[model samples]
Target: MTDALLVLNAGSSSVKFALYEAAQPGEPPLLAGQIERIGDDPRLATGGTSEPFGQSTDGHAALIGGLLAAIGDLAPGDVRIVGAGHRVVHGGARFDAPVPIGDAVIAELEALTPLAPQHQPHNLAGIAAVAAAYPDIPQVAAFDTAFHRSQSEIAERYALPRGYAEQGMIAYGFHGLSYASIAPRLPALLGPEARRVVVAHLGHGCSMAALLDGRSVATTMGFTALEGLPMGTRSGSIDPGLVLHLLSERGMDVDAVHRLLYDESGLLGLSGISGDMRDLLASDAPEARFAVDYFVDRCARAVGSLAVSLGGLDALVFTGGIGENAGEIREAVGARHAWLAIPPPLAIATDEEGVIAEATARLV
Candidate 1:
């Protein structure tokens, strides 16, 4: 019998999970899978196991049920779920690293909803589902904003006043779990003092972080998730004045502005078709090319600025969906940073699921 550690990463429309044979810290997972479009007919895919689980419209609870059913199919007695880990997007300044979830922790996460309304609700939903599914198993919270919590106050703080800053209005760099997964490896990828590293995590969402000795010295995202690089449908780094103009001049309310920034911009807004990179790349529409070019240009600029922040760049690491799969985006970002001498740009497939399994195993 092997102890299995289950990990759930719930996004806006889907939930992904990995079931690994629980081992010591830093070990890899045994099997992994994900279910996209959970509420509607979900798309289920597995890593080690090849047979695809077909359409089911049971939502997150069904997804969990499907996973449990799948595990049962593979010698239920051998696969013991020791613990579960979840990826929560924003922790504000409350969590500096991964922590065990509790009633107080749930309260703390609930309080930060205003900081990450798009993700926090779904994150809590997945967490709540897990709590209900496996009430006895110990669950852990792995904050995407946690690793960057090591960033200096000056780096995280905005130029705004103190009251809002006290109310958690600051830059809490995201993709911390992904960043942390590749951090220690940077030294091996570069050198022991690999002091200056700029990592761009481009996926459904995107952000750039300037790391000095594995700790976040600066990052592109600020105060909210919408402040960084343009993503699948997110409008990044828009002027604050535009927000006011939208509210006052364009008859847009707070919720309307939020949707525009969080759901209707980026590639979808530019291409006027799809938010997915693959779809845009495959399309013949001029808007598709325009959207792709715009994404690359902005990301290149962010890397240059982040590289400047680190004095110079030692290594440029790419992770996440776009970074790992889209060779074109990486090449574009790489071409921009070619001035850096020796050790050509490196792109590593980030293992957030693996990282979660490892972290959860240690605490369990």
Candidate 2:
């Protein structure tokens, strides 16, 4: 039987999976799929076929079990899953590389939950579920925060007190696996001009990074994913005083404010219609137009700011869902920086699963 690697990217509402030949590094996945909407109206899509799940796949474990069963049915009988790689959102200050899953590593990741409450727990749940099902299989965690570890200390620091900075309240950029996936392909795409590049990873959770010679020198995200550009349902970087005002003057508690910024803000709040960029782009409503305009403005501003960090812009690479699909967004953001005279922004599809699979294969 041919050995295979299973890669899992578990989000709050969905788990995306892919299987690759363990002996093949750059080959395409043997099978890829996602189980979306975990708690509400679940659906499974694989090999271009989409269908509602017949079984009750309520939690991460059940959903993953169902996914495994589906893969077993679809995969060639000669294929054997030898290892699993996971996309973990936060690696905290301790981990800067892919690591083998162990009790100690799991506990350390659990301590980082408060740093990324929306993602860390769900990621851990996926790891737990995989362990329960494939007790002997080796699993490796490839972190989204690990790529930014190459960034300098000054770029990662906050202006807060020394004590706070020492306490891990510094900027720890996210969307790293995406950036990691794109960095290697740059030299081929841009050649010598790839020295100073700013990659905008615009999706439901948006962020940008300044890469100097393929290394992350600066990024938009901070200690949390909420610190970057305004995203689908996230407010991005809002005034800290506004949060305090909600807590005190508006009579809202921390939990209420959290829900507001994390779930009720961004494009959805701005348009009062939908958080999906596809929806906003299609709508003729003034609010929708304004939200789109705002998103583009901030994106351009981020490029300019990141350009400053790179000393100048050699290339601006766009990836992630919105960046890859939205032509109007790319055009508008590019037009704002037309003065730079750089070539058009390059759109590269990210392969976090492939990166995870490679890491898992190497470590295992």
Mark the 10 consecutive residues where model 1 has the least summed lDDT. 48-57
Report lDDT (Cα) of residue 220, candidate 1. 92
What RMSD does model 1 have? Answer: 2.4
Please list the C-alpha lDDT of all candidates, in the order they appear.
0.81, 0.89
What 10-residue stretch in candidate 2 is worst by lDDT?
A: 53-62
TM-score for each predicted model, relative to the true structure: 0.92, 0.95
Tens-place lDDT digits, model 2, residues 1-364: 8899989998755788998999995699998888875665678888789888745547776777777766787786678889999999999887999999999999999999988887898789888878877899999999999999998889999888889988888899998999999999999999975699999999878999999989999999999988979998899999999999999899999999989998889999999998889899999999999999999999999999999998999888899878999988988999988899898988898888899999999998
In candidate 1, what are the lDDT values of residues 22-93, reduced to their tens digit?
A: 775356566666776454457776654444354564656556666665655643356777798988998888
Q: How far is candidate 2 from the true structure (C-alpha RMSD, Å)?
A: 1.8
